[model samples]
Target: MDKDASGPKVVVGVDGSESSYAALRWAVRYAGLVGGTVDAVSVWELPGRYGWSAPAVDMDVDEEEARRRMRQELTDVLGTDAAESVRTHVVHGNPADVLLRAAEGAEVLVVGSRGRGGFARVLLGSVGQHVAQHAGCPVVIVRSGPS
Candidate 1:
């Protein structure tokens, strides 16, 4: 959160939910105010049942395809100008861990209050809670925008 740095580096977690999109927007606006870049991180993983159900069967997961989809979503939300100050990454791991790593030297980490998790009845997603509690930098939780 220094002012003399080469531009603030903001890290944001995204999962294609309305809340995540709002977090992305809020991060970008904050970036503009702080004169910084944003790293949009999207995470995906194999279904929980994949490993337990069948260890012999090889599940085909296209990581590149997931990355492509993330890039598209970043573009769709941030528009073409995303290339200028926004970098999107599709990682295969725990969302909270990935975001915490990405925000290593970042000024702050942003996330939605909720994501596309199975526990939709909950107020906050587990990933957000993890990051908010354990991140090295500040954490901003943005709720979904107006519908």
Candidate 2:
């Protein structure tokens, strides 16, 4: 683990969804206030039910592309410096597991209540619920509502 004397490290789970973006924004603001850095993470999971017969898509889509897109989206919402403060990470695994692992040394873990799911009515997505339950550090679930 990389220890920093500067300030605590804030980890935020981002998936290019509106809710995740909101969480990322919140994390950046909180990190700025606390004199910390933000680690923006995006986890890509392979469909488990597909079995071995499922044709493989381009699962290894460029990490830089993902980071670039995330940065662009965040920049649109919070400005260039907000995007720059974020260090991007792209990992392959279950979102919840990946996020929990990343949150190990973080001062705070931030996630969105609901993400880009097909089911619109789902109050909380699986990843959000899992992180809320299992993250080692403090977790902040950003919901789409008045703060």
Candidate 3:
């Protein structure tokens, strides 16, 4: 992915979770504050339980659905005007790996305190915890408001 020509880049991971939406909003606001651009990324991975003998699946459809969800989530969180300016990506890979890769050379990597796969009792999601420790740039973990 290309860095924004106008300013620094802010990369944020988005899943279809309230926490992720909060993170997206935070990323956009922070990008505005820093005169940076936002790259809103949604990553999906095939079920690893299937291992080498996984059933055939339509990869294109999966990716497109991810893109659609990302767009819908962005509009839901940031509204059309703000969402339109942010660049979006739908990637197929491990969530943390993809996000960390996307964050390379970025001003900061933003992610939710937790994503869909983690236990609610935990303070941070597995992917968020991983990226916070491994990201090349600074990482911002935006916690969701009280339920």
Count of clashes, each model: 0, 0, 0
Q: What C-alpha lDDT, on a 0 to 100 scale, does residue 81 get in candidate 1?
A: 83
State the TM-score for model 3: 0.89
Worst 10 residues of 2 by lDDT: 48-57
lDDT scores for all predictions?
Answer: 0.83, 0.81, 0.86
> What's the lDDT for candidate 1?
0.83
Candidate 1: regions farther than 4 A off = 1-5, 48-57
What local lDDT score does residue 142 receive in model 1, on the 0 to 100 scale? 95
- Model 1, residue 74: distance off in Å is 1.5
Clashing residue pairs, candidate 3?
none
Tens digits of lDDT, candidate 1, 1-147: 122337878988989898999999999999999988888888876656334464444478788888788877877887878544677777877678888898888899999999987886778888899999999999999999566
**Reference-based lDDT, residue 26, model 3:** 94
Q: Number of clashing pairs, model 3?
A: 0
